[model samples]
Target: MTAEGKILPIVIHGDPVLHNRASEVEEINDDIRQLVADMHVTQEAARGVGLAAPQVGAGLRIFTWEFEHTGDAPTKGEVLNPVLTLLGKVSQEDPDPDSETEGCLSVPALGYPLKRSAHVRLQGFDVDGKLIDFEAHDWFARILQHEFDHLNATLYVNRLNPRWSKRWKKELRKQGWTTAGNTWMPGDDEDPFGHDAEAANEAEES
Candidate 1:
């Protein structure tokens, strides 16, 4: 499908930038603003709920979300240099242990059960650099946490249970992925899916 905006190439796992903390967005200039818009297009093209700067080869602390599950109008915008706070338990009513299984654009064909606060508050600036703060609950809250993890070079798989984590590592190894420090990705010969399997993984996770 044709996207209305530029769809930047997604940086795959094992890329150093994905394992390092992102730099704060100090200025919301033309480049940054264009990037924010392009990221939204990339997210939509991949059918993802959110996208982060690092995922698009940028090391800026920024992310965009398009959440339609908040039972309100779809919440869509960019959050620059975001700070997140958990508001309360994951679910005030009927908190189920199995309620949070998450999928990632960076990890294809894999889903990990995660634990995230059911309610949260996110504060950051928009593409225009105006300060914005808001509360989120349920799925929206989970999406925020997921995207927030990106700024710290954290993937949802990093929060997987020990057993599942080990299993995922084994699977990755079988696909010829190599590890450097805490990051892993497909080896040169293993990159049969476009730029890397990880990038294709992102496209499919949506």
Candidate 2:
């Protein structure tokens, strides 16, 4: 983390910032660099593998990720205005429920299954405005796709099949998250997921 980095409040699902498409970073300057740095701190505080600018209430097309697969060197960095290309034909069928489960910081604790391309190519500029291009597979690819969707104003729940989507929407309503301007500060707030017995059972059934 940079010396100026601070953990910013993570916006919740109801926030308009998470629903609208993010703007491209017009220039990589101190503000943009500091935003990325703060995002890294916020992601670490939330114990998340990936986080997008919208999640931090910034409508900028930026995201940061840090993951270390077993036996592989850690992959960690931030990208601005990323463009993703699926490597092959994507499946229309719903992904296996047992696998491909994903959770979002913006959505708090709820996780759902969604299909994603196993391989993808992502191109973007780093914080310093240098171009970055690379291909990723498996979990790395999934992370990129998730963040890319944020830039386009598509949440993972919005991509779920009808049944799950309905359930997720209902749950969101039940939780009173249908409005904008909601946020949660990591460490300061109680566990947002609140994994109580009933909540766990509800998730299992959903």
Candidate 3:
């Protein structure tokens, strides 16, 4: 699994693994370090800013992130069993269901307008089992929240505005998605993203 072409594939929205609460990592051993490294490789392949353990079909509370945000270089690292504390006031800008939104590697084609706390304080450990704590803002903060959601078995789709949510459900139905328990699964659709790729591209540019 450490070799090229062995990178784990990202589990999609309909996958049951994405809907279950991930178990906390009890220790940071060789296996987890490899998993983290593999996740980074997988995220890079998918062109994603962040990726969670569950997204790779692992029920572990861990995630990897790499994105540029006003620092010496792109903030890159892995957080195991992270705990996030949101800070600062909520932005006054209302969510525009079809505007600049966040997309997920699991839910390939759709982007959803979501409002999240502008700043967050994260407390977690690194691969060495050392304590790692920091405060994040703006895009970094958003990334933290997004990946954190995955640890709780939630997706960005769960944060979509009512209008966009309705539309998303409609599109799922059109794609033949059926609800079972707490999650929806796509059926026979080759391209789950469909037309949402354009919107997702726009979001990336901004």
Candidate 4:
């Protein structure tokens, strides 16, 4: 949730900002600082791992994830901003390739199996701008890719194989996907933010 305690709205498939590249964050100013904190609170409240600024309707290169919080949030957590993330030098060959199922807060109900590097070393800072480093394997590396995609206006949906894509379409339709092109519908899951569930309702109505 945001500082106002209203849950931050999530920009889903049809949102324009989710398709265009995000702007680079120029300064770690108070607004940017507040963004990281807001993303953390919002993501936790939404039960998400990592969230980018674009997901929250900001067209800037800011995202937050907790290396420590695998599933729980606020319970034990540190919210990070990528501005100071070092993403250390791990050569292409240094990390092994692995595939795993992945999902997004932006595209709920449709998770697809995708490949990613098995390990990573990242340097960044928490919401307070305190320096932090993240060394992770498997799922954690996947988290890095997921969060980074938000900066580039990419979604895990783009990574789905043809087989997975077909399966996703069928299932998402069952979950109420109405947009004919590249779009997704909110599943039966609870949406803390009103937009997704409302979108789902609208899709079904039309």
Clashes per prediction?
A: 2, 0, 1, 3
Error of 1 at 189 (Å): 18
The best-first sequence of candidates by lDDT reads 2, 3, 1, 4
Estimated TM-score per prediction? Answer: 0.78, 0.88, 0.80, 0.66
Candidate 4 deviant stretches above 4 angstroms: 1-6, 67-99, 124-133, 169-206
Pairs in steric clash, model 4: 85-123, 85-124, 86-123
Global CA lDDT computed for model 4: 0.63
Candidate structures ordered by TM-score, highest first = 2, 3, 1, 4
Highest TM-score model number:
2
lDDT of each residue in 122-161, candidate 2, tens digit only: 8898887778888888888888899889888888889998
Model 3 residue pairs with clashes: 109-193
lDDT of 4 by residue, 10-82 (tens): 7666577887888866666778666667677777667677778888888887777665534322323343445
Give the lowest summed-lDDT range of ten residues in model 4. 90-99
lDDT of 3 by residue, 63-147 (tens): 9899888743239988999999989776657685564488887777677788888788888998778887888888788899999
lDDT of 1 by residue, 71-157 (tens): 443388889999999987653343234766787766655666777787888898887778878888878999999999989989887
lDDT of 1 at 131: 84
Determine the backbone clash count of candidate 1: 2
Compared to the true structure, candidate 2 yields what TM-score? 0.88
lDDT of 4 at 168: 71
